[model samples]
Target chain A: MSTWSMALRQSDYYWTLYRRTWKGSVFSSFLTPLLYVLAMGVLLGGFVEADPSRLEGAPSYLAFVAPGLLAAQTMQTAVFETTYPVLSATKWQRVYFGMNATPLRALDIANAALGFVLLRLVLIAIVFVAVLAPFGVFVSVPAAIGALLVSILVGAAIGMPVYAYAVGVPNESSFSLIFRLGVIPQFLFSGAFFPISNLSPALEWLARLTPLYQGVDLTRMLSLGTWHTGPALVHLAYLLVLLVVFHRVAVRRLAKRLAF
Target chain B: MISARGLRKSFQQKGQEPFEAVRGIDVEVRRGEAFGFLGPNGAGKSSTMRMIAAVSPVSGGSLRILGLDPATDGSQIRGRIGVCPQEDSLDTELTVAENLYVYGRYFGIGRAEVRRRAAAQLEFVQLTERGGAKVEDLSGGMKRRLTIARSMINDPEMVLLDEPTTGLDPQARHVLWDRLFRLKQQGVTLVITTHYMDEAEQLCDRLVVMDKGLIVAEGSPASLIAEYSTREVAEVRFGIGENESSAGAVESAVGRRAERVEVLPDRLLIYAADGEAAVAAVHDAGLQPVATLVRRSSLEDVFLRLTGRTLVD
Candidate 1:
């Protein structure tokens, strides 16, 4: 078998396992994220989101904020997929050690794990987009698909670096920091609830530097059917570089930890 | 199928002196032969096993598994060998059969083929009826047996079992031994390590006795016992605190009757070809305060004779 095939075989273990365990979290993935979108975008948007100064020329506040929530939810799903489960695979349950005992190299196992994480990202992003579709969140179907794809890239760009860090310092205490300090702040400040225009110049610059803000920028353009090719390309390039560099880091760290 | 020359492994912890787990030990495991490492804890038996399995890098010396250099061809060598680590590292998330099938896929086995081997291995380990059971539901012995079955999923040519029966009951140990013996009969090489001399004697065709990062002795179980220990031993135990306090008197009384004598905390062992005569000589010397039993020598005796200590601390 080819190396990719070998990696896929390694990932097959997770797929089979997830099939048996996914039921417990099915509602959280769809209903919970959807509820957050409806409550924050529809119910809360009617009173304050109608102000034109902050809506960024979008038709409605729900349209303006729906794409940002999609990006934030993607980031949450990505970090969730990479940290605790990956640590268990290496340090606790020792599934990665079990796999390394076979013909698979540490690189193959890392790649397989990354592949499984991305698959989960795709499934979750699709559900998030589906929840927003009934409320006229999309100007065009293809553009909505483009936003979903870009949001996945955004999740991965952030997820890979977090995964790299998690594999090395494998303790439960660090996870609270990721969620409280890292994820929740980005979800709130990085144009998810309001445009960067609403933030002061310093905070907007800081938000632009992070992955979720770039994701929101590119996805907002796609959702409104207003393609700003120049800025969109920058967002795309920023995300691609983040994914590549962080993926390399994650692989190196995991290999160092797993192999002698 | 496995050879090593002056193999060594040393770990360097920050702010501490480097600890040498295996200090330049040499070993050779022939095809279909049961080779054993009998040693106490911290004697580097598991470190040596990791080096042979290609999971750990060698700090010094040359090593080859199936004629492949682990430095360059670790994955290639790992593909053909199986390791049952000292800890039961079975995946508890999957069912017993699912664990077998999933582990087989790590060897790049096809789905249908892995399924077939998983079923066969379950039967081989006598867990066929519990295939659908979750791994956590099985008893400790069953979990151990399932681990053994997982190791065989790749149908490896050589299998390394580190302390395969350390915490197991006698019946569980015997059952696992039966499965291992069947593997040997099918022409599969087995490498095992344990402190249990009886286990070494029963499982090893040839073995090495290691202590404090060195191989103190190496031979077939019978030859090592014959070379290092007497044919029989007279074990005498005194009442209460008398065993330790009466060491000098017992040594002088029965010392010359036997070839060698060892004083332990609880008992005094007099080694000789004729143990009954040694006991009678002890009685004639007016040292008749306790109980005595004479038994044939075992690897435990050889270990005690060579190392000047009992096998079980």
Candidate 2:
């Protein structure tokens, strides 16, 4: 079968599974980040009001964190969705055995899984953007849509490698380590919650190398309409490179793992 | 057609010896025939099945399915082969009909065609009434039938079933057998493995009895029984004490009447051409047993004779 057909089929399969079995988790997954934005930006920032810097132009703190939160939430959801679920379908539940028994190849299954993650990222981003509109965070409708697409691409770029790692390893400990050493570090040091310029030079260099930093930087640029061509190109290049490299790895690993 | 020559597979264990699961065996399955691999657990039946299914790589051998090398044309070969794995791997999140519909899509079937096939397959498995029910709510038998129906979504040329009736009740097993029989009648080649001697006797046109990664015997059920065991068997039991040492006496007493004598912990089995005459002779010899039964030889006898152990062991 053609790759597109297989990918579309697998995406539908995952969507059906998620809608029926994971409906309860979807609301909480999309709601938690919105609450975080409101509590951290409006509630917390109101009590600690300080003179607004020039970089922090017209929008309030809530608007500033809104796009970054959307990107971060998408990354979080996409990474977990692709990694554990992919591993479980292969090793734990062994659902791919049935799928691969048909015309679907391993690469088809991988693409389908990635497609599903992308779709979920977009859905979550739309919810985040809709919630932010009431808080006066959404600047331009077109820019908000562009930011949402960028969030999905960035999340997928980061998640595909983790998906590859999850399928290759035989146990769950490696995923735990990735969450502890990889994801936690990215979440804390990637300038999602605070400005990176205030950090030490060594920390900034480390943060700049992370996928989350590039993603948040791009989101911040889109949200503030402060799109400098050079930084935008650099962030786009980083995400593109990651997407190509990790997608190749995921396809190869899945082929070796699922196909004989 | 499926063919394999010098097929071998070995698994390396950490800090211990490497276990050879399949050891240089040859096999061929022709079109429109019911072939079976009959063996006890850990006899490499599953390893062989996996190799044939093209989901597990061959360590040192040549294998082909439908005139294609699994290593190169795995997807193409799999496209025409249905596989019912030992475990029921149905998507528990989906409804009965949705499970079939989505699995058909995996074969690149169109949505309209998948819907039509799903309906027909669900009806074939007698699950049409409960098509909308979630998978987790189905009984084990229903789940197994659904898995079988899911495998046929592509209308494959061959169907591979690994221990299809391993954990089903008698009625459920019979229902599955009936469905498989109908498929065989429609000229679909079937490959199956099971430890149940009765299942093999009922379904297999030809079978290989495997033990410890090797084939010990290969033939039809009737032929294997005729070759390995007598036509009839007699079981004689005495209510001796737990610590009794009368096994030797019983063996000596029935030795002349039967072709062979098997002494168990609680009884003695006498293999003979005519079980009724043998039991009468035992009575004539004044060996008053607590219980006695005469029956025809079964595939279980063939298995025991070849492997030197019970099939369930």
Candidate 3:
């Protein structure tokens, strides 16, 4: 069989597995951002002033936080979705054993899993953007589209490494560590909800090193049309480097784990 | 055909010893033949099977399946081999039909063809009605049948079944055996590992008995029986108390009439060419046993004689 067909088949397999097992989680992913928009944007925005300094020249707190939330939520969903499930397919559930026993190769399974995660990110981003647009958070149609694409790239950039980590280990504790030390730190330091200028220089440097920060910055640039070429290029470069590096690591780890 | 020369595998445990799971062993399985490995647990049957399935790398050996080396051409070799693992590895998230459909796709089968085979295989396993129901809802036997059917979705050239009927009920086992027999008739090479003597006798044309990662004997069931045991076996169960000495009585009773005498915990087995004459000799010797049964010698006796222990032990 052709490589594309094999990859597509694996993609469909994961999609079906995800739909059956994680449909509720998908709905829950959309609900998290919706609640944030309601509780932080509308409820808190009612009392707080719409300061341009706080929002970095966006029209409202809702507008600024909306794009960042979209990007952050996509990263969150994609990272969690890919990590445990991919690990389970290898070690716990052993679904990969059955798949590898067939004509499908390790690269096919990895590509399928990443492709499925991207599809889910697209769906979740659409719902998130649609929900936020009516609240005066639609900066521009092109910017919104750019935000969606950036979300997928950023999520993949963060997630693919976690995927590599997941396939490399044989237990669930490694995933927990990734979430606690890897993902949680990214959430706190990546400037997803707050400005990086407020943090210490040490933390600022560390935040800039993460894919989540690059993603949040990219989304901010796209949504607000406030382009800073140096930082923009740096963020894009960080994400691109992560994609290539982690994708190669993931392929190698999967070949070792599944191909045996 | 599948061939392995000096196949060896070892696992390194953390802060402990490195255990050799499969010692250097050679094997050759011709096409359209049923090959079996009969051994107790921890005897490396599963490990050897895993290497042959191309899902486990050999630590040192030359291994080939369907004329392709598993190390260099694993994907090509695995593309045409179906494997049913010792453990049930079906996807519990999807329905029985979806399980087969997804597996077929893993073999790079087209969507239309996957759907068609999923339907037919489900029917073949008598699980058409449960196709839509989730795998977690199905009975153990039903799930096993689904696993068997799922392995055949690609119509593989060779199928490797590791203890396929390990935990099934008798009726379920019979049904599975029938299905496997039909697959054999269709010219598919089968490589199986089982400790069940009856299962090995019923399914395998030739087999190798393995113990501690080494082959103890290799031959047809009937030939092994003929070589290892007499034509008939007489079983005598004594009603004597636990502390009573029945061994002395049993030895004196059929000691001269039978070719060999085995003293088990619960019963005494007498190996003889004619079981009727052995029983008469035991009665004439004035040993009144509680129960006496005469049956044809089987592969179970051959295995016990060769390994000097029970298959389960």
Top candidate (lDDT): 1
Q: Which regions of candidate 2 deviate over 4 angstroms? A: A18-30, A50-60, A134-142, A168-175, A200-202, B15-17, B238-247, B264-266, B286-289
Which should have the higher DockQ, number 2 or number 3?
Answer: 3
Q: Report per-candidate DockQ.
A: 0.70, 0.59, 0.61
Off by over 4 Å in 1: none
- As for candidate 3, its interface RMSD to one decimal place is 1.7
Q: Return the candidate ranking by lDDT, descending.
A: 1, 3, 2
Task: Please report the TM-score between candidate 3 and the true structure.
Answer: 0.92
Q: Candidate 2, after superposition: displacement of residue A110 in Å?
A: 0.7
C-alpha RMSD over true interface residues, model 1: 1.3
Task: Give the per-residue lDDT digits (tens) of candidate 3, residues B79-157.
Answer: 7888888877788878888899888878778889899999998888899999899998988788888988998898889
lDDT of 2 by residue, A126-147 (tens): 7776777667666687777777
Better of 1 and 2 by TM-score: 1
Q: Across residues B58-172, which tens digit of lDDT does each residue of candidate 2 receive? A: 8888999999998888778887899999987787767999899888877778889999999999999999999999998999999999999998888999999999988899999
Worst 10 residues of 1 chain B by lDDT: B248-257
Better of 2 and 3 by lDDT: 3
Q: How far is candidate 3 from the true structure (C-alpha RMSD, Å)?
A: 2.7
Clashing pairs for model 2 are none
* Candidate 1: tens digits of C-alpha lDDT, residues A142-214: 9789989988988888898888888887687878998898898898899888888778999889988888898
What's the TM-score of every candidate structure?
0.95, 0.91, 0.92
> Which residue pairs show collisions in model 1?
none
Docking class of 2: medium
